[model samples]
Target: MLKSLPMLLLAILITSIVGIIIISIYQIYVSTVKQNKFNVIKDASITVIDRCGSILPYWLPLLEGLQNFGQQILPDYPFSLMSLYKKTLMPFVIVYVTNPAWAFIIFFILYYLFVRPKSPIPNRPFIRFNVLQSILLFLINSLLGATFRALPIEFRTSLYGLMVCNTLFWFVLLTIIYSVIKSIQGKYAKIPVISQAVRIQIDNQS
Candidate 1:
């Protein structure tokens, strides 16, 4: 366990780093999109100003000033690719990966009903428990995320709250990946409650 401590810490650190990077990237991308929208509005106004110069002589300069003011005050908001990615694609992927609502249902039905204890596979027990623990972790993360989401948007969007939530998400994801690798190597991952539950179920089956 002492020798593995560093590996565990590294896994967690990697997870946290990934979360930070993704969040930072998301913020940067969104900001870029907003700026782009504002720029587009300003450019369109300038184009109108130029066209009005040829069509209207006396009002051209006044219209140009008003259009410039409007560009500053009422910039048109375009549909950003970042918004689409963050709101639609990211959520779908996150739900599929982190939420065990569907995974748990499918895995349990398949594992218990079809996978027998006396299977010839040498690593069957380890694989079974690994999957169980992974599912449990996913459920825990999903619930945690949901609970955070239930908070007021003001708090949920705060830096501190976002950091905490991201850290949890990253930690669970990295830990699950690490656990899977260990199981493939015929090692038992010592996840506290879930591991104990897996052990109990295994013994009862045996």
Candidate 2:
């Protein structure tokens, strides 16, 4: 019994040490970046208009994602808001994506009204960043859709196409959702690659 007790004590001691090390590492990570350190945090200093402005732009990508790949993800379930949205709102999104004139009108409005360097209506950095990010997302999804269309019909209809579409759908959906949530919380969504590009472009213009 004493021999077994020594082994048990050693096992517990090792476990305790390992646990402490893991907790220390976790604390370090949290201390360094766990509170979304890279993201811009909005507080009382930020206005309601700026926060609200940031949120609406994300819908462009959200709708674009839905228009392109929603059916595959959210099948027509009865009484689903998505189903309703697909029925009511998808046609307009389809027009926005397909008709350059309609899209251009929107782009003209947003570019002139919000993100442009010298706009009549004043804009906030948070609003401008979110709007630009949304525009970038829209452009990306458009390019991807066009590229897919250029591929041979066989490839477009193959398992590989499904995989690509699914991946893109998640990318657009998740990124926009994250951005929207952050905007709601008055923070910038610092998504890799995209956010950096948006920041660089905005900084250059500024």
Candidate 3:
């Protein structure tokens, strides 16, 4: 019990911090939406569906990347997200792993379709915002993955490495889920530094 006390406390602290952040973000979002009521769309269903689709292109590649990262490092578990993923989504993963170029192709396609400014194509603010967020996530994942690969081989297979990889997976999963939920509610997902950067990029494009 004594040995676990610190871990328990750490878990509690993390939970509290996450709760506070979520509530604060929601409050700020509500206020912002109120101030920009005219800009906010009342018809959320259509927009929600479209916005949700924005992340799908990024999601598969991220999934494939995680699985590849864990190839030799992670041990076989009878029941885990990766295991379940393999059981159900192996086909998609295989395709992505085999042809990594598809992620880049999709990225370019999404940018041209939704993110490009002043072109002959139509632009959508909500979906465009989500797409940009997804793109940012993909880039961050790729960078971190490269950094992760730079670590010593022994350390890469160590418990700490597993923790790092797990953290990345959780971050990707939770962010997408949170973003999708906000999209479903016709609200923007404010992902701290990420959303701020996206906002600046959007402003520049405008």
Candidate 4:
């Protein structure tokens, strides 16, 4: 039991890191480049909220800070809205790879030291979702990165199809994951057609 505790903790940490990475990507992208369509922003926000919800009250403050920053900086930008959106989230990119683990550690400490003892919700779903999301993101990103690195430089130069498909697939997957997490929290999550897959997963798990 003692040995398993560390492993379990590590799993939770890794999962939180992946979720942070995904949110970092979305935040940076949206802040730098303005999306004309509301759907795009809504989808991205839902993903952010779903992942952020796990971390609880901390996320709310961080997001509020970001929003305040946006109000101050966005109006002064000269480029297209999309470019501005991307720039805002750029700071988190390095954290995704560098101290990714720190985000999870902080969250775990926060929960264990405070929330877990007071909150009525069971800890199992929260821990399970964090672990599941992190493992999935780690596998997907590592595979994609490895595949891209293994390909010849010349091959990558002409791989627009691969790039496009990968981006689309990632966005879709994020939406699905976010929706599933929301459902698990007993919320009504709507993510177009992808919510069906999340429902299927939840059903199977139960």
lDDT of 4 by residue, 72-184 (tens): 34444566864765664334332333444554565465445434434445444443344333333333444545565566766554556345434534453464456444533
Candidate 3's TM-score reads 0.69
| lDDT per model vs. reference | 0.45, 0.69, 0.65, 0.45
* Residue 159 lDDT in candidate 2: 82
* Steric clash count of candidate 1: 0
- What RMSD does each model have against the real structure? 25.5, 18.7, 13.0, 13.6
Candidate 2 stretches with Cα past 4 Å from truth are 1-42, 71-100
What TM-score fits each model? Answer: 0.45, 0.70, 0.69, 0.38
RMSD of 1: 25.5
Q: Please, what's the RMSD in Å of model 4?
A: 13.6
Tens-place lDDT per residue, model 3, 1-206, is: 34434533443355455545554575468559754875644553444345445434445435545654645433454458557766654545555566667667778887887788854455667778888888888788777788888989788778888777767766766776777567555567899999899999999989
Give candidate 2's TM-score. Answer: 0.70
- lDDT head-to-head 1 vs 3, winner: 3
Compare the candidates by lDDT and give the number of the best one: 2
By TM-score, the better pick of 1 and 4 is 1
**Model 4, position 121: C-alpha lDDT score:** 50
